[model samples]
Target: MSKTDFPRRENFCEFILIRSVGNDSYLGNIWSDEAKFTKNGLFKRHNSHYWSNTNPHVFRERNFQESWQFNVYCAIRTDRVVALEFYQENSNSKL
Candidate 1:
């Protein structure tokens, strides 16, 4: 989908924590950095992909992660995640 499709919101942040569940031999643990809400109100960045080693086919086959901790700025509305703009904390140049 085009980036524009994801509308940016304001003053929001979300932190997601992902972990492995069982001996599925496919999944892995992951810990994402705090997802800041950009002007569009969507998550900015996602860090840590635990299952990077597995094949795409196998990775998609099973559900393996145990739990997720989402430290969101506001209450989650629906399944739809608000869009946001991503920017570095420290930048020398202007946009």
Candidate 2:
């Protein structure tokens, strides 16, 4: 995908890392709408966070054979992710 297809680099602020629970890892990307203003004085105004989760069962169903699996979490706005936390499943606790 082209750079434009993704959120503006200038608008990106930070990434919140979420721990895996039940082999699912959640992640959040944060951004600011004001930073998306173009040089021509036009504001794109699309501020939001992207979240994703990883699931081992889904991966295995897809023919993935990895010993460990993770799910990613996503968010649409900075406020949506007030805090980041990580959790370990019984299988992953040893690691």
Candidate 3:
């Protein structure tokens, strides 16, 4: 594949990883700076939601640190995410 086939580094963003308390289960979600997940945070980035379904206001650092095993992962492109969530979905299904 050519360099053109790869997404530019600037397009890449940080993601969040959430580890469930008292269990081995883990979750990777969108990134949010407000969470301040320095150790737990992933490379995914810039204002995205921290978790899949959990509200940002609720799934915060205080609660997470209290419970522990929280937060991050690898890189993902926001542009691709938008394309899949909006453009691709419109073509794929009505939902």
Candidate 4:
């Protein structure tokens, strides 16, 4: 946000954290707790099966693995959420 977007001279922007386990969900505060986070993976093209011209591969089960994505995005502010905890089984797909 720019300086002109500020509504007042002093403002407080609170951070929010949320988690979901399939149908169930949970919401909590991230500022008060000393939260630790794992670094996100690098951005690059990912291919499970390699392409080859000289070799012929046999077909097996097409479903190699189940892939799920997760991300944590904070607003543009000084007091922002720096870290987060993400459980594989129960993770929030969106903010």
Candidates in order have lDDT scores of: 0.36, 0.34, 0.34, 0.37
- TM-score order, best first, reads 2, 4, 1, 3
Candidate 3's TM-score = 0.16
RMSD of each: 18.3, 18.2, 18.0, 15.2
20 Cα displacement, candidate 4 (Å): 38
Off by over 4 Å in 4: 1-40, 44-64, 80-95
TM per candidate = 0.17, 0.20, 0.16, 0.18
For model 1 the TM-score comes to: 0.17
* lDDT by residue (tens digit), candidate 3, 15-79: 12223344333333343321223344432345555666556565444334533232322333423
4-95: candidate 4 lDDT, tens digit per residue:
65644233322222233342323333333222223333222233455665555733233335544443433232345555554333233452
lDDT of 4: 0.37
Give the per-residue Cα lDDT of candidate 4 at 23.
Answer: 22
lDDT tens digits, residues 1-95, model 1?
A: 46754453211221121222344432332322335543433444444244556565543232346422233332222343343334545223452
By TM-score, the better pick of 2 and 3 is 2
Clashes of 4: 0
Candidate 4: residue pairs that collide: none
What clash count goes with each model? 6, 18, 10, 0
